[model samples]
Target: MVASSTTDAELSPTVRVLDPEGRDIRFVSALDPAGVVAHGWLRASHRAPDAERTLPYRPWHPHGRLDPLTPGAAVPLDIEIWSTSVVVDPAGHRLAVTVQGRDFEFPGEDPWPRSYGVDTKGHAIFLHDDPDDRPTSVFGGVTT
Candidate 1:
C-alpha cells in the first residue's frame, strides 16, 4: 500500500474494498487533493471464478478486465464503508463514492453538506443527510 502523508485533519473517512479472503484490495478517500474521490479493484466476469454464483441477472463480458492493484492477480471484492455510498461500473471497472466534507459535524444542530455517489451513467445515490430519522433506501433513485 502506498504511504499517505496526509494527516487526520486532512483525511476523510475511507471506503475500502476487500478481496474474498478479507484482504484489502484497494481503498479511496475523499480527502485526496487529486479529486481521486474513489477507486477499487475490479476484474472481468469471465476472469472471475463462478461469477454466476452471485447476482445471476447481471451480464459479464469475456473480454472485459480491470487492472489489479497488485501487479498480477484476479481479485474478487467486497465493499465496506463507514459513512459513504459506492457505485460500481461493471463494464468500465470503476467505482464512484461519496464523501462528506471534513468540516461536517454529526449529531449536532448545525447544518452540514451532503454527500452522494453516482453510477457510471451519472445517476445519484444519496449518502448523507440531516434528520436521521427519515426512512431511505440505498437503491433510491435521484430525488427532486
Candidate 2:
C-alpha cells in the first residue's frame, strides 16, 4: 500500500482495521459515488485537537480556535475520515486513496439526480467560485 501528497497543504489521516477477516483499501474521495468509502481534512488553522476526545483511530479537533501557519514551516495536521461500508475484492479491483488539490468530479453526465437536492456534479454548497477568496490556491505558492 503506497500513498503520498502532491502538495504541502494536503489532507491526510490514515486508517487501520484489525479485522481478522480484513483484506483491503482504496483512494476514494468523500461524496464520490464511484465507490464512496471515507474521507476527511481540516484547515491548517483548525488543527488543534480536543485532547479528551482524541482516539487511536480518530482524532477530534476543536474548531473554536485557529492557529496561524508559519511560513515555509512544516506542521502536523490531524484529519478524520468519515467511515463507510463497501465490499472490496483485492483480486479484481485496486484500492486507490486519492490525495489531490481539488474535489473529484464526474467526467461525463452526472449520475446523481438533481431532484435529490444534492450536488449531482460534485462539491458541497460552499460554492467556492469567488475569485476574491482564491478558490484555486495551494500551499507554498504565489496563490493560496
Candidate 3:
C-alpha cells in the first residue's frame, strides 16, 4: 500500500488561547497579524467542527482591566498558533512566537492599539477602520 504524508503548511492551523492553568479557552475568532508592522488584521477561521468537538467553551474578556503582578492578579496566558505557542506576559522581556514550528521571537514591546470584541454570534471580531482612501474589503473592489 502507498503511504501519504502532509506538511505543516498543508495542515490547517489552529489559534488557541490557554489559561494560566494550561486549560484551553474557546473563542470565536482571533486577530491575525497581516505583517510584522501590524498594519491590518486577517480573519482567522475557526477549526472544523470535528476538531473542536473536544474543546470546552470558556468565555474570556480580553479588554478587562489589568493589575500589576499579585497573587490574585490576572493570569498569564499562552496563545498558540498551530504547532507553536507564545506565553503572553506584559512584563516579560522576550516575546516568543512560533509559526509552523519555526521560531519567530522578538524583543518585548508595546502591542499595536487595536479594538476587538465578540459579536452577537459569539464570533471574535476585529474592529479595523480602514483609511478613507483605501478599499474597505479585499473582494468586490469596494472602496470607502
Can you write out model 2's per-residue Cα lDDT over 1-144, one digit (the tens) per residue? Answer: 112221224343323222234433323344433323554555565678999999988889878886655545566766777776666544545444554434433345545534236563433322333455433443434213
Which of candidates 2 and 3 reaches a greater lDDT? Answer: 2
lDDT of 2: 0.47
Query: Per-candidate RMSD vs. true structure?
Result: 17.9, 7.3, 20.1
Taking all chains together, each candidate's TM-score versus the true structure is: 0.16, 0.59, 0.18
The top-ranked prediction according to TM-score is 2
By lDDT, who's the top model here?
Answer: 2
The TM-score measured for candidate 2 stands at 0.59
List candidate 1 segments past 4 Å from native. 1-15, 32-82, 87-144
- Clash pairs for candidate 3: none
Give the poorly placed runs of model 2, Cα more than 4 Å off: 1-35, 108-112, 115-118, 122-144
Compose the digit string of candidate 3's lDDT tens values, residues 1-144.
001121101111234444465433332224433222111121111111233333434222232332222222223222223223445454423332223211122223435233353221111232223444222332112111
Clashing residue pairs in all predictions, respectively, total: 0, 5, 0
Model 1, 23-110: lDDT tens digits are 3333234442212333222122223334554344333433345332332332443322334465533343533243332212223332
Worst 10 residues of 2 by lDDT: 1-10
